[model samples]
Target: MLDLAKLASQIPGISQHFQREMTASRQRLERAQVLIRQTHAKQQDLIELHEQWRDRLIFSTATPVEPLDTRVPITPAPYSHSVFATDGSQISPSHHEIAYCYLINIGRVMLHYGQNLHPLLDSVPEVYYKSEDIYVAKQWGIRVEEWMGYRRTVLESEMLAEMACGWVNPPGPHREPNLALVDGSLVYWFLETLPHDARDRLLPPMQAAWSQLQAAKIPMIGYISASRSLEALNFFRLNACPHPTPNCIVNCSDLLDAQMPCQVVSPLRDVTLWAYLLEPGQRGPLWRSHARILNSYEECHRVYFCYVHVGTEIARVEMPAWVAEDSTLLDQALSLMLAQVYKGYGYPISLSEAHNYAVVKAADRVRFFALLEQEMLKAGLRNVGTSYKEARKRGSIA
Candidate 1:
């Protein structure tokens, strides 16, 4: 009874402490509820996305739809006998080089080639160059000889084809019935390179060659060696990554090991491979029949081991299994030839896709003659004393 006022004051302090605890507990409960709601929302979102993707994949078709055919009948056949393989290499005074090679049996042949124009100057001008037209003109001037040489090689190849066809169909002097093998694709390269004026002159020869081949019932097929750049692109796509530049070197096996499938644009209605595969034609509806295999382990192996060391660019997109298989066989043949020809010199010979072009560079043409001689020996033909140096002196180029 004497301390009633002090007791009342103590009661307020105790009430305040109780209120503070209640408030904190309530705030914590509300925060926990908010967190739980957010987690559930995230989980639901993930589930929906997973379901959508799973459904799409389950319903999507596995192969491409066949394309309508409008062109003439063209079919591939197996080799019979007497196949001819041809190749060409181009080296400029500036050290920029290219090689094109191919093989043809009695049936079909494919030819391929590549060119690298090394930068004329290592360093660029400091100031911003304003002469666009003039710059282009200058650049063309520098590359004109190379372009001409390449064109000439293609022309020569066509001439060889004509010669082979003439030999096979009706049979000509110093010619026997044999399959003409060119180390390249079709006549597209020549057609693309020829000037409008010169095209008229060039077309007849090419047409004549093709006609002769057709008359002989010889099928023409192109073979392409696996390229690192091509493999890099394939790996990039398989892993849902960006395509690599030509300069990039990648471990192809590692890419396959990832086992990831990319979201590819469906080129046709029904093909998964077609999403990655390249075809021949430019315009019109994409054809499934023309679709070729892309991103195979075997192809990657070949690309890594064979083409990478030789330094080739991946130009064409689609790679057919038949072509790849044939190319490997051709490569083996060329390798055997190289081993036989340059046994002691140790000068490694590399075969190109276009025209089966082989390259062996030296200080002078004497080395070339020796190589030619060796090739003749392997072919069981006598050296006819046709020296490359003599040909050069006479203004007769290869």
Candidate 2:
């Protein structure tokens, strides 16, 4: 029931607005490219400037491990390799449901290339209905869905760790070069907004999972497609800052009404900026993320990332400091990832298959509630009922 005619009528104005924005964006992109080229020649000074202003900046930034403009061609993938990927889906608790509970389903995949062994496609589903399970300090106004999200993250990491550990010590004498892949950023930046108690609860378990992967000597990667991260651009902006004394708050206060010198790069993200510089199957330089959450992580578990240009899209690939520091392992990871992307026709095949297993469809949700209600009734709980709003939704009387 979208009003297509009305939407069509507004297309002219929308097109006009889009044109103006695109024109502005193009100008900013040109200026940013110029700034990047200029800074590349003075890379040492920019690095010094970053080190000097590292403390005063409020936002997360990146430290370049190589020249800012470095573009590495894709390394050749190994003849044989195994990829373990894990993704998760959840059912958010609804007030209209017969019970106050949520479920997390982790879809895991193990794929071996250049081998006759079959791939493993599986899912692990767990339900949480206990009062403690649904509430991570409910008194602080934390919703069940929010708590479940963190729980799912923990569960996904644990599952990935289990797969990685298993890969490290397989039952048979056959083993291929392998890596563990997850579908999002490893940094728990959102944890900064939570209380200390919540942080203590979540961080330790996640770190423990990471420790397991590290102990297994597995290269784990966090892949993000169509990434909008500003870490790289922000780093260049910090270098582009014209103030002699760099104080993000005070030095830029006067320029609030006008465009600041650093704002020249504001229109582009790290991915788009690199797309112009990198050819297909190439990767930009690695960067160390200085997200504040890393303070809670061990030095070995600190996150590093790079932009990879696949034929269809630019992706942000993240890994632990240890993986990035090891040149051999890093090259293996990037090559295997590129091969997977080519197989998937733009995305990683293992991650894509894992997502297929994790996704919870509308029919599945309805069936889940029905089964829950049936079980409750079988247990002699006669008071189970849905909210009036839910009832109306199920049977609309138009």
Candidate 3:
């Protein structure tokens, strides 16, 4: 059994560490606030910020997508519209208990404003066991493909895109101007971290899916709640530097320490920056994401993002440039997003339903194995065994 008493004693020490970290974080937060105060409402400051972002192409940075639209007021959505949201869950292969297999399942829900369909749901599940699909070879050696969760991210994009494919051709009379929502970033942000060969292998499917969604004329969004991304704050950091150059990264780390004029908002996130500026139902202006992987996308499919104040929290919403550029689709998407948030009691109802649809409970996994074992026994094969340690825990004294 665990040592509950000892764990309790360690609480004070943990609390001490947390307090120190908060003190440091607060200082940076203050600096960030000061930076914003100096630059807010200044046209020249925005221009300077833009130039710094564009100049530093070495690292990811955001530039103003519109002349100066960051302060656009919130606009109410149409009275009626349709929304679709998708989410997924997975069961990974484990040598400890289960067979060498993995499963990915997706769930989707569609909602029409002020109306309930008799039924509104979809699901897809796939299992994988092929050797090549189950493992990846790294510089050190081969390991299960699930190690860093790279594959799952690809699967998410692939699933969402695939599910949205049918709508790609043209809008039918039956279809309403619709908004598609996913519970994460529009881009496979992790792909950039993978080795080139691995990245190359995973890129095609995601691209194809996005292409289909774009072609369908659907404005799809990736929603992240309480996000910590600092795209806008990073621009402030660049502007705060006393000595500005094309390559601020080269010496900025050290420079920021000595001439740290921008400590007030040092660690500020984009949502936090926008939070102080936006009213409920308002959204930040669309800014192109600095994610380098987006460069590989077709011109129309490049990723853009905005911060939406959903009453309870600020959320980051990402979409392809094609969606962002379309005024009619963009407004409807924002309106529906806001409505979903309210319906969900501070979350997106369709996404929450999709999550519920795809979740795999532990009892479900046990039943799966039980059924498998029963079939194996009927076929004259021996029962599958748990690991020796697991067996011992289950009363196997022998």
Q: Per-residue lDDT of 31-148 in model 3, one digit per residue for the tens?
A: 6666766655464665566665555434456655653346655566566566777777777677766467777777877667644543357767767767666765455243564432
What lDDT score is found at residue 41 in candidate 3? 45
* Index of the highest-TM-score prediction: 2
Candidate 1 per-residue lDDT, tens place, 1-398, comes to 37897688799889999899767655644543343234334543433343343222212111111121111111222222234344544332211111112111111222211212221111111111234411332443434344444444445446556544644656444332233444443324344444554444444565555455555544333334331122222221322323331111242323332342332321111121212222321111111111111121223111111111111221212222322244443333333322312321332122222222333244323454455457667777763454465456656553
**TM-score of predicted model 2?**
0.95
Error of 1 at 20 (Å): 55
| Candidate closer to the true structure by TM-score (higher is better), 1 or 3 | 3
CA displacement after TM-score superposition, residue 250 of candidate 3 (Å): 4.1
Clashes of 1: 35
Task: Return the clash pairs for model 3, or none.
Answer: 29-264, 30-264, 31-263, 31-264, 31-265, 32-264, 32-265, 168-216
lDDT of 2 by residue, 227-288 (tens): 88998888777667778856776766656522766667675788878888899989999999
C-alpha lDDT values of all predictions: 0.33, 0.85, 0.70
RMSD (Cα, Å) of candidate 1? 26.0
Q: How close is candidate 3 to the true structure, as a TM-score?
A: 0.83
Off by over 4 Å in 1: 1-80, 91-142, 171-179, 187-195, 198-204, 227-360, 363-398
